[model samples]
Target chain A: MSARRIVALSGGVGGAKLADGLMRVLPQDTLTVVVNTGDDFRHLGLHISPDIDTVLYTLCGLANPETGWGRRNETWQFMQALASLGGETWFRLGDADLAMHIERTRRLDSGQKLSSIVADCAHRLGIRAEVLPMTDAPVRTRVDTTEGRLDFQDYFVRRQCAPVVSGLRYDGAARAEPVHSAVAAIRSAAAILICPSNPYLSIAPMLAVPGLRQALRDAEAPVIAVSPLINGAAVKGPTAKIMAELGLPVCAPEIARHYGDLIDGFVLDERDAALADQIDIPVCLADTLMKDIDDRERVARASLAFAERLRAEMIA
Target chain B: MSARRIVALSGGVGGAKLADGLMRVLPQDTLTVVVNTGDDFRHLGLHISPDIDTVLYTLCGLANPETGWGRRNETWQFMQALASLGGETWFRLGDADLAMHIERTRRLDSGQKLSSIVADCAHRLGIRAEVLPMTDAPVRTRVDTTEGRLDFQDYFVRRQCAPVVSGLRYDGAARAEPVHSAVAAIRSAAAILICPSNPYLSIAPMLAVPGLRQALRDAEAPVIAVSPLINGAAVKGPTAKIMAELGLPVCAPEIARHYGDLIDGFVLDERDAALADQIDIPVCLADTLMKDIDDRERVARASLAFAERLRAEMIA
Candidate 1:
């Protein structure tokens, strides 16, 4: 098969690292990344897709290495001024990073399609990767926490994810139709890879989009999921705590099972290699700790090699 | 009168300089500046009041000297990306500057009044001088030109003011009422000083507001207009070129005629002192060249000193 096309699913930081790895291995235009829009929120009247921006900025070499999100060398003068002005500034908006949100919000207001604007933003940032939103429709990941149902930002930023999430719901998911690029990527894929992101908060929202999950399930391509949970903890964010809260084991097999029939194969970190046999799906063990650019590239190569092996088995 | 309250009418850039001077020289709460809003435009879905911000930044000690607009220490990454995105970025948005506009737009979208927002902005910037918009209504300065009518920004920035001005019109002024602060400033003022800004583009728009000119004409305050024209050239901007284009002499007395019965006095540059004797109103001559901070203070002091003389004449 002529250099196989691959589609990857992602959220923000953790997902972006794997996505970056995939980009390093895959040929230009060979990879299509479908990012979760569940974390998307309007802040200061600007439409901000945190995950999408993280992926885009990481791919474009603009992301801050220390934070693993937002642009490098970002200034907080605006936020400082906003705070001084008694404006709501819970979600920190870096000066350089804010321009993207502002332009996106502006274009969205001017009747442009979200996908087109995303494409425009990617092109402006000089990113070559195909970054697609899960859907054009707005889907908010609402957390029904102990503090009451709060918006994703309120739960994540305002409360510092301190609120115990009793349950999570992707608002507006029922009507969300997958974007044409997303569907096209899946249908024509050589393989589909799920990046190590929060399954409930990130991956679920994309799957919840009408017909998206079914498209992946029915595709001839092998579907591989990179476990976000390593050993007994989440590499980042609240995935492990959230899993425990929802009465699930904080292990690789548990995360693999979370995908159910949607995943044909799984990649677990070396730390969780011992538990790989417990999962029904074919599993590969590799170092998934993408701590730096080199680590990202190494993990990406392993994921690509794993996908290749799975695809060969599917052909056999 | 208790130390003579001073009200200054202003727009962006050139107006901000005098406003800065007034802020330095005038006692706290002694000056009320009614800034023009015709140059205000919505960019990236944010309501940007250029003149208001100019006055605010200048008064707060933040105006960039090199550009004569925007904040000091501003970064242009946002504008660079904005241009790359194929967005209409003729009006440059510096990264730091974008934050203020974004937050202001957000607050305005939340149904907050522009007056209150400006007040909050001034207070946050630690500016004691009152900065008020000429009117809260959406009024744009449209240039009726040989190249066809264009918005103020289009005429000024996009076209680089290359278009031959046939006439200038305030598109929404007939329906716009002066904001309460502007009216209150005019009514209770001990003296009203019009900054040496472009007459047709800046000051006329303020005057165009339905009853604003009438309010100034009837105010008990001695209204003084500083001539933007000096030595057959404008102190700043296209005042002289536009004046000549409109079939009027590029002279100080012509500015006096433009204001007509609205003023009790006029201030001219030393170069135009000879023509002051021929004007209908009482006139004063001073350097009126605000080249730096000290110059700004000098011009401000001179204007106030002139106001004092006008006040003394009225009292006598």
Candidate 2:
């Protein structure tokens, strides 16, 4: 068989780690990453694409290793000065990370699409894999909480995700057209992998875009998803809390049910191997916790291998 | 006599220094500084008012002592990152100083007037003296050079003022109205001291505003100007070079002539005392070199005293 081309739908941090691993394992230019833009917002008059930046930084080897967000060795001089001026300091913007926002804001204001800007930035950063935003149009993730609707950043950064999320809404998703590159990549893909990110907060936003879910459902490739939850808890972020708040079981089977028939195979953590039989789809048990680059590559390999098994079963 | 209320029209750097001096010597709420906004431009999607920021930083004791502009303890991480991303780095925005630009741009985008924003910033910075922009309206300074017309920052910062300035234009000044605070300050002023800023590049922009020049002319206060030139040289910036390029004599008399009938008195450097006979206005010779806070206060005191002398002459 010819080399497989893989398209991965990702959010920030966790997703970025796996995307990086996939880039390492896949042939150059064979892996395409479609990042969630639902966390994008305007802060301090600059367009801030949190998830896109995280993915780009992670792929370009500039992401902070400690936090898995922002640039490594980032300085807080911008935030310090901003605070001195009595400006908003809640959503921290590092000095190095601010460049992306300022430049993106300038280009966006000058009428350039976000996808084109991201492509140019990725090219400049020397990333071989194609990194595409889910959509060029604005798609903000609003979290409905007990305190009412809070912007994604407000809910995540400002409030520290304290409010119990009642429901989630992708503000502009219905009207936003999926970026042409993403659709094209999906259409030609040999396998589609959904990275282990917050399923409701990250993947759901991309799925909310009118035709994107349908596109995934219609893709010829075997679709596989890595569970964000290992046992009954998310490794990071508000995924588990949001899941419990939404009255859903916080487990691998639930994650599979979340994707339903869209995913042909699901990768579950070895720790949660016992729960594999409960999942309706074809499942692979592996050490899904990506603690470092090695683990990331291992998980990525297992995911691709699982997709290959599913494709073989379909052919048989 | 009642305590004098002074109003100063200033540009950047040199003008800001003297304004700081005046603020130190003058009683609370007795001094109002009207800053030139002609150098204001939208850079990287942020409104950058060079002169106004300098004045604000200077007056609030936040300006860099070495640079005479921007904030002290500034970090260049933002610029470094910006350069890496192929963003514009010619007009350097320091990490600490960027807060001013971002905040100002945010407020401006929200339809707030420039004057109100300046006032709020000054208040937040703990500045007691009133700081006002010359006009609330947009009035960009465009330099007509040997290389053709260029925007103020393009000529001043990007080109390092290397272009031979043939002439200057305040693009929107003709239709711009002076800010109400500035007009009010000038109308009721005991003296209007013109700071030692570039006559052509700085003060000329303010004068270009339709009614501003007329208002200065009709003010009951004696209009006194401090010469930016001494011994045929500018203390800083391209003032002397611009003067020579425009074929004007590089001396205090030429500075006085530039101001023409608007001034009743002129403050010249002690080194230029011999040239006093050539000036039409009453001239006060002092050490105009403001190397420190003491020098700034001394020069400020001399300017005010000279204005008082001119007021006495007017009464006689």
Q: Highest lDDT: which candidate?
A: 2
Tens-digit lDDT string for candidate 1 (A1-316): 3566789999999999888888877787688889999999888788999999999988888888887678888777777766766778778878767777877887888898888888878877767678889888999999998779999989888887898889999999988899988888899998888999989889999988876887898889889999888788887899988888888887889888889988989999999888988899899899999888889888888877888889898899
Over B199-281, each residue of candidate 1 has an lDDT whose tens digit, in order, gives 88999999999778888988887889987877888756888888888898878899899998888888889987789777988
lDDT of 1 at B88: 69
Enumerate the candidates' DockQ scores in order: 0.52, 0.80
Best by TM-score: 2
Calculate model 1's interface RMSD in Å.
Answer: 2.2
lDDT minimum window of 10 residues, candidate 2 chain B: B1-10
Considering the true interface contacts (CA pairs under 8 Å between chains A and B), give the fraction that model 2 also has.
0.82
TM-score per candidate, chains pooled: 0.95, 0.97
- Candidate 2 colliding pairs: none
Total backbone clashes of candidate 1, pairs 3 or more residues apart or in separate chains = 0
Taken over the whole model, the C-alpha lDDT of each candidate is: 0.85, 0.90
Q: In candidate 1, residue A163 scores what lDDT?
A: 84
